[model samples]
Target: MTEQRFREFKMPDVGEGLTEAEILKWYVKPGDTVTDGQVVCEVETAKAAVELPIPYDGVVHELRFPEGTTVDVGQVIISVDVAPGSGPVEAAAAPAPAPAAEPASEAAEPEGRQPVLVGYGVAQSSTKRRARKGAEVPVQEPAPAGTYYASPAAAIQGELNGHAPVAAPAAPVAPAGGARPLAKPPVRKLAKDLGVDLATVTPSGPDGIITREDVHAAVAAVSAPVAAPAPVSRETTPVAQAPVQATPVAGARETRIPVKGVRKATAAAMVGSAFTAPHVTEFVTVDVTRTMKLVEDLKSDKDMQGLRVNPLLLIAKALLVAIKRNPDVNASWDDAAQEIVLKHYVNLGIAAATPRGLIVPNIKDAHDKTLPQLAASLGELVSTAREGKTTPAAMQGGTVTITNVGVFGVDTGTPILNPGESAILAVGAIKPTPWVHKGKVKPRQVMTLALSFDHRLVDGELGSKVLADVAAILEQPKRLITWA
Candidate 1:
């Protein structure tokens, strides 16, 4: 019988500077057969909860940690055995040279073939995380000339001995005492930022110095800014400066939040895409009155009742249908392999603006879904993003994307193409506007469709044709018969 080795899989730091993660639930247990791309577990980091997909396909041999336990990164989570006749199977043993055993207590060898932990694992020194740039560190300083400082250990010793650590009495004051000089510029700036005044902050640095950190602590104590002194009776006052009412400095009052998460990811992707890929955007305004009439007709249809049918949904469907005609639009450029991957399935991404940040969660294989299914998927995607529950997996593997800025009451704007995708469609507001319908001026529900594609992959002619076809389907819903 061929010996089977189990591969141990460890939990990786997915993102968001995760230190420890709580295992929400496990999708598989011992003896369960699992495939690659299957959701193995859901874990909650500090920022949000994410469903983790497995990268290897095997039968579950054992699980190391149970659900709800907070596991550190690089900890073994699961073990899967290599099937018989799977080839390249090795018996479990220590790969490194082991010293002559002296019967030291050590962890038992795992029962079955466990995955050899590689990559970021094994090296304890490499796992040490440095603090981020803006993180604050504590400061330690000596006591003043007349005051005495006691170490925490000494204080504890005194407490045990029935005496508490106390400051020594100050020396007698010298004659002709003068006010101490004020804090320095950096210390004053720190105080300003912390909302502490130089006069109020205690000097803790050497020689009765007021360090920047002391001012910072004083400012932090007063978390919220103190309200301005109530204005004196303006009716009775007629002074030259009017008492110089204290007003917060304009720019100084603004709060600065660091860019992170989706915002940070979006910025990095956009810059890489904008500069690397030569973007060519083409726009076309279409009279969508017919589409509006169809929407109104469907609103009363019994089959579509209780569904949140909207113009954006129709536009999304139209774009999907057009993608079938021009495959170049739904493709990716693999610079490394010098290949253009034409995707048959559509991972349709919808750009949604939520409270946290802008997120584009794609509907996997959207082209294969029915109208109702697509609508429900769209609804769920929007709701998940709104609740900040959209997983990172749902936001990836998108072949093409659509940004519906019309929801924000904006007419039209150029949208950045999502990285890895060749093209992105921007759906504008469908509003009543004067149109040239059959050579006559009339108000109609018109909309502008802007298609931004990578010029290298999709040419002007192909892009225009795709956009025109989508518009045609919207202009006359009956045309979808041929397109679909």
Candidate 2:
């Protein structure tokens, strides 16, 4: 009789050194047949939501955890039956063989070559199960040789039994006259977390699947009209309708959002950068009338058509040019090596405020890109960040950053350095102001630029040179061509 074998798929380290990820979804369930490289689940790491593909082709035997469960790397997340048919029929047809002698170590090294999948590490010799507290059941003796067992627990006891595990029953049916709400696992988890019933919420997604927006809309509907009590009758005293006040329950007036994910990582990096590096901020107010005019021209230009053309784009180009001229400013302090690491290629990070939190996703080799390419990269970066799809790799190895407080209508402020980056440039709102252009006072477009740098790597002279170069480029827009 052919023996059926089951292979366990472990939770991989999806991102660089990511230790854990929350199972955001399960695309394949038990009894479902999956093929190699087929996406089985979507997991949300601290970096981003990534879909995981199974490396082996088989029938899914079991899912280790439900959606929203955080699993550590190297943990088995699913089991698959490699040979589905070599179970009851084969076992009953063949003669039973005597059980082999047990080895001193339970985990015997696997024979032959191990299957290697990129990103995911090689399969281990044996799988280890996490002990469940108070849920431990007596270990059942291995089924007699040639017998088939469907349970994962039974399969794990020995390889003699290898039938596909039975699929779990479907969830309870919805109330009469309605079907269970169709939603992605993450959306369902979000609705559950917000104390929302998916059945009651209207679905706005394609094919009636509930979306995050739909769940939020439902919450808003419930929270709206807080003062729904009948209006005071004219019988007693006609009192003006008072604003409804939400009474605190259990003295909890403020909602505490747990700091995690991007927010938590940002806070840690900011605190570390702030204390570890000596920050010196230098501000310069520049007359950017020429730069603003250039921006308009670029918007109308055939080359720049259909691309995002704004003050930020020009400002970013100015910074890149400045970095090129004052290359010394683009460096990082390596404390362990006691050296200043200068970068020839610039990964220009743009600070974006996302729904999740502030994330600095950078454009790789921005210094090499043309104006149009830079604009495209910037647009893609901003859009990806806004959608919370920025990956951890995109946010790494940044040489410098630009935070545009100008978009928020702020004049100027000292910006904090992103950890490892030597300098950060903050662009303020560009407004029409009276400024001396060629020794004549005129209403010209003006903006403030602030450059904050790590004093260890970028001294006052270098920081000032970089900032001044950017300012000069903005003042005289033709410098970009000459400088390039």
Candidate 3:
């Protein structure tokens, strides 16, 4: 019987100085056999969650970590036991030709330095292609006289052939020189799906990389402007080409969606928040007539023209002012570390309903901004959220949140707490209703405010006081100056 060996798979630093990652999910188990290129786990980096594809085929000997554990890059997460006389150990040794059939050379190596995964081991400065099998003639495409293949594969092949890959002889270059315009990965995918040639289309991405908009523009450019189809007489009528249709692959009936961008980030965040934090919720409703009128006045003011003045803006401003007054709401409860984090500066999160899902991107240092500055920041946040371009920075370190369910015409809802923040304020719709105003029964614009907080940090009195203060500010905008 041949001897068997185990290989430890350490997580690679998948670019950026990402120190640690949260294991969002695990796709493989201790008993499951996995092949190269199969997804073994999905991990959440600081910016996004990516599915980690396996780099070797082997039986799972052990799982070093479980889901939800924070793992440092380059730490061993799993071990795989390779079958005796398997391709794995040989291919791993193949890169070091001296080690092949030389037990003496392997015995001299250090204990922890042996290569693991075959074909791809510890990266090397120099590379050589594996010799191909069977009888075959060398195939080469003529380079454009002075140009050569700069790809690593071709260069390595050239080195193995005992000659450096040389540039082709020069010729007069045409405008395009048979070179296709560059496009982004997404744009290239779009062009392939739309049957458009990127080389013939104009580019709009930075430095002439094709954008999705560019392809749409190209499609528009190629289409002839229709004049009403001239009356088709029987003599001149011709047979029409059948419209091409995409066929669904057998056994594939579901829509496939890319999970890279916001969707992935949101999922990771929600999961982290739900699982990590202990949540407690509370609610309150207030008549916000004065704040509603203040919005109208701000809209009509000459100083605030050409600006989007909305009630949510005032709610955000009020929330910031209230946070300054009650510092406890602008905090995070860190249970693991046995500490409470209190932030002096407010990272006010606005939970906006985007086409993708709920994204709570925040305004940094919101408490420092003046009314107009806050309004401008709120405007940008809303517009960016709607366009689905909210950056990761805008989504972190939220000291408090305001979810304007009012926009959806909702009266009240117990919103889930944002991941790190201690409090989330749900602002409901303002409608004209009967109310007591100036000692008289009259119609007034009224709205409900629901404040949800982590009870572990915020007590009933503290939460109620914070809720009442916000209601007082909205009920009388003049009261904000005094209460804040």
Number of the top candidate by TM-score?
Answer: 2
- Per-model clash counts, in order, read 9, 0, 5
Q: Which stretches of candidate 3 lie over 4 Å from their true place?
A: 1-253, 353-358, 384-389, 434-442
Candidate 1 residue lDDT tens string, 184-237 = 432332333232435566777886767755755664576743332232321111
TM-score of each: 0.56, 0.70, 0.53
Q: Which candidate model has the greater lDDT, 1 or 3?
A: 1
The stretch of ten residues in a row with the least summed lDDT in candidate 2 is 90-99
Q: For candidate 1, what is the TM-score?
A: 0.56
Highest lDDT: give the candidate number: 2
Score candidate 2 by lDDT.
0.68
Considering only N, C-alpha and C atoms within 3 Å, which residue pairs clash in candidate 1? 5-113, 6-113, 6-114, 6-115, 7-114, 7-115, 8-114, 8-115, 194-219
Task: Please list the residue runs of candidate 1 whose C-alpha ends up more than 4 Å from where it truly belongs after superposition.
Answer: 1-72, 75-130, 134-136, 139-251
